[model samples]
Target chain A: MWGVATGPLRRRAVAQNLSTTLGCPVLLLLAQGYDRPSYVDVALVLALLGPIGTLVFARLLAEDLDEDPPRAQALTWAAAGFAAAVVLAVCVATEPGRAMVKLLVTGALLIGGNLVASRALARGMPTAEERHG
Target chain B: MDDALIAVALLLVAATATAAVATRDPVHQALVLSLLGVALALLFTVLQAPDVALSQLAVGSALTPLLLLLSVRKVWRRRQRQGRTE
Candidate 1:
């Protein structure tokens, strides 16, 4: 496994992925303690927006990251796997129903979005000069 | 137990906020600011305000940083262009 590098953009990407994934456990904790089904929406929104946020950075900071495009393949996949595992655990804990389906959808979005964002970061967006030229 | 979690979240918010301010570089400060947003969301969630946390996640985790980074990029590009013209 390649060690995670220390570039600023790379670190930013990693932090974004980890924070988004962290929401799953927080959701589970809230569900366990509180009887509120609405809290799940927090995780859902996070799963939805987290990657888009990263992509924003990837696109806007392309020039800065072009020199050291993040390449944390192992870490990104590990975080995605962790998210999938959490979603599965939550699914098993909850009775199968709309909530389970929602959880599954959120999990799919979280994993898929993070993967796409990471790939974009690794690939690096085209610089303005390159785009115009 | 819940108190401990809240305390931890509060600590995170303080630490990240302080770091965001202390960092000199706008780009790095934006990074810290995003982390601060995540911390604040966690604090709000612990305080049993998921709605607030949701909005915080939306704005803090991504949008604020995006705006900050965009501004920094624009300024840097303008400076570069000015340097070329001069």
Candidate 2:
């Protein structure tokens, strides 16, 4: 969090994306450790919205990051995979049922959104014409 | 075990909140604030209030940052226009 708050724009954005991705596992852990299935819903909503917040930064700060974009492919993959593994382990513990299905959905959304957000952060937006006009 | 987890979450929220306030830049503060929101939501969940966590995640993680960034962009644009006019 400090990294995101103190670094330059590029590092700040990357750190923001990384924070959202990493949040998935912590949410899952909280759900499991507390023995509350409803807690997973919070994780689900977070997974869905974290990327949207990153996209907001990417769109708004396009000019600032145009000179030098940040790319951390390995880190991005690691975070996504961590979310997947944690979700899978929990699903196994949960067994096959409605709750497991929800877990699977959350896992997919978390990884997919994480990938999309990191990719957007790495690849600067196209020219204004293509994006807006 | 859950006690330890809750303690860690409380620490994370505290640290992230401190970082958010410590940062000078509005943009960086927004980023840290977003993360702090997540940590706060997790803390709420650990405390057995997923409903509140859900609302926090909705507002803190995405909406707050979106609003802050949009306003920041608008202010920057206004400043640039003013500079050009001057």
List the DockQ of the predictions in order: 0.41, 0.79
The C-alpha stretches of model 2 lying farther than 4 A from their native spots are A128-133
Candidate 1 per-residue lDDT over residues A1-133, each given as its tens digit: 0111124657766676566666656665576567676777888887787787778777877767778877778877888888888788888888988998888888899889888888888878765687885
lDDT of 1 at A114: 87
Query: Model 1, residue B15: what's the lDDT?
Result: 70
TM-score of chain A of 2: 0.91
Which lDDT tens digits does candidate 1 get at residues B1-86? 88998898888777777666677878767666666776787788889998898889889767898889889988998999999999
Best by DockQ: 2
User: In model 1, which regions exceed 4 Å deviation?
Assistant: A1-7, A126-133
